[model samples]
Target chain A: MSEADPVLLNPEVARPYLDRGGDLPALPLGPEGLDRHTRRDLLKEEMAIAKEFHGGAMWPYAVAAFSCFAVWLAFFPLAIMGELNLTVGFVLSCIFATGGYVTSHEAMHSNIGRPGEKNRWLNEAVGAVSTIPIVFPFSMARMMHLEHHYHCNDPVKDPDYTDEAPNALWAWYKTWYNRQPGVDGSIHHYKRILAGMGTPEAARALKETMLLQLVFMAVLFTMAWSGYAIEAGLLWWLPRHIGLSYIRFYLSWAPHHPREGKTGRYEQANIFKSRLGHVLSMGMETHMIHHLYPGIPNHRTRKAYLALKPVLQQRGVDCSAL
Target chain B: MQAAVRGLFSWMPLLFGIGFIAPLIAQIMQRLDIPAPAGISPILFGLLIGAPWGLLTVVRGRWL
Candidate 1:
């Protein structure tokens, strides 16, 4: 294939690079009149398997989340008794939180059971227990997340890919604020989200969190009043918000950064497959695959991701670690 | 700058207090062979354990 073919430097490949605040380079499309291979076909088989795997794994993920929740509550009063220290409680709590989040994520994708009412109820119930209310339903997240996959590198369209001017400015302001005070700027960013005074999505999430917090406060307030309040405020509330905000920020950015001067859908896929690609991404890492096939479950994503790695690389797509 | 410095200074006590007190308490509990207390209700137990654990796990899994 000669380097002069226009297809090689198609608009889809070039547009994202330009959006990442870079100069546009002249891309040479490979050899004229060359037959393009069926790109989607390459992933067809893997995509099918990915869907199947996600379907089966969703229930197990839900059960795991519920179990973690049970364990967390059983051990929580120890905080009041001063039997369990903050760090240990914090660490153990984090483990349970992760399990819950993973279960919710699977439910969001309908990976826990059949994609119907049963799955929705399970997702919402699990979500409520995890402190993410059913108000921000899995259906809503799935829809937005699908958009994120569809326009992975498009700075304007992908809700998750926020390179918008105002957002960027806020991010910059946040960094400066943290640096000036020797506090991690990221923490400030997180606190802002926890406040639930930002975007609509944030507001919705915050509402759910606040409701849960209120219930938590009531319980703590009733239990030896002062002791419960102190433990709940110091250990439970602050840490949960901080931890949730931190993870959200990292996951939001990991999959769609610019690489090798490309920043469009294809390059985003490349990044998703390369830098952020991992077994744990649970199908999230195979961002390109997810974009192309949203119905595929997270559990099956690892296989699809690996299957397309070599082919994507050959097409001049570079996936680099962040 | 002064505010930053003061804030930093103030946090010293909080840091030391939490760091010292937490582990010390855990050690005492260990020595006494006391098991951590469970929540009063099943749902409460789930909330206490699930809520914090869920947040921590998600953060650790993603960041670490």
Candidate 2:
């Protein structure tokens, strides 16, 4: 393919550069147009095993996890009331806040309640409540997340492209840098993308984002005024910052690092060893599988990735990490 | 109206961080027996330090 090939705009390819300076590798994007050499029977065998992992059993776990996080967030006030130890509360809040995104993420992909399924309300409910710690609204998260999927490494279109950095330390710095006032990163960046889209979902997301931010600020101000500023800082504000940084590092940057020119589906995400391990790292080691088959629930991704590994390798995916 | 709201939201962190969190932190440090430099009052010390840092973040969009 020449430098001017139109395939660069395939929505899956990160194209137009959008001022993210540096040379993008000119590899052919993703698995599109590639023929799998597997016999029909063998291909069917691979798909059948993979399909077994995609289903609705994820709802119960999603609901239970959402309840735990909500209850945990509720306990923050008890610490302010002097009924709980602030140190203990802060530690637990950090754990819950960091873990909250994966559950909401599962709901974002509709793994909890797929469209037309009987339990779709439960999915939306989980998504709505799960991110209370991080203060990101479900509507905004869903809209932005879906767009990231559609344009994974797109610097201009991908809300998460801001997380892209040269190394782990820079990636960590970006999570905070993106949210600083006047920086078009994090929610601010998403607001720009949503404004450009001009869809009902985008509008709703923007509205929800505003309301959530107001509520978050009101709560912090209330706590500070009530002589519980320390409690508020440890319980919510600090935890949210730490959790956002961790979530962005593992969930966005690590999975899709060196994002330039990587617009293809298979090329978009990678399997890599996480220093924090699978559960601690938010199950991002198997993130590429989730990108390929979002319907597979988070808990089942490792198993499904193993089952589908041969087929992925056959299709030119880099699966050596697992 | 939305733009106005967004502008307010953008200014909030700096305002809250400097005005509330910084002074409160000063009080906590004092309680832990840490003395402010130049014999300054804890709240004044907090304001002295936080005001410039917060203004910088608001202007440059980063603290560091």
Reference-based lDDT, residue A113, model 2: 79
Q: In model 2, where do residues sit more than 4 Å from their true spots?
A: A1-46, B37-40
Model 2 TM-score relative to the real fold: 0.86
Candidate 1 residue-wise lDDT, A1-322, digit = tens:
2333456356665566567977654444232212344334434544454555334446666676677667677656777677877677676675555445556665555545544665667766665565331122333344455555555655454554432223424543432333222342332333333354356665564444344434553453454233343455445544555445434433444344332233443456534442334644434455565555545555665666566556555544554532
Question: In model 1, which regions exceed 4 Å deviation?
Answer: A1-37, A40-54, A82-85, A114-120, A131-147, A150-157, A163-210, A213-225, A259-265, A269-288, A314-316, A319-322, B1-64
TM-score on alpha carbons, each prediction: 0.54, 0.86
Best by lDDT: 2
Isolated chain A: TM-score per model? Answer: 0.61, 0.86
Model 2 pairs whose backbones collide? A12-A263, A13-A263
The DockQ figures for the candidates are 0.04, 0.44
Docking class of 2: acceptable
| lDDT (tens digit, per residue) of candidate 2 on A1-322 | 4323445456455443434664544543332433232334445776687789887468566766677686686776687678988788788888778888888888898888778988798888888888888999999999899989988898888889999999999999889899877788988888888888899988988898889988888887777656667788888888899989989989999989889999875689998889989888778999988887888888888999888888777667778888
User: Which docking category, incorrect, acceptable, medium or high, applies to candidate 1?
Assistant: incorrect
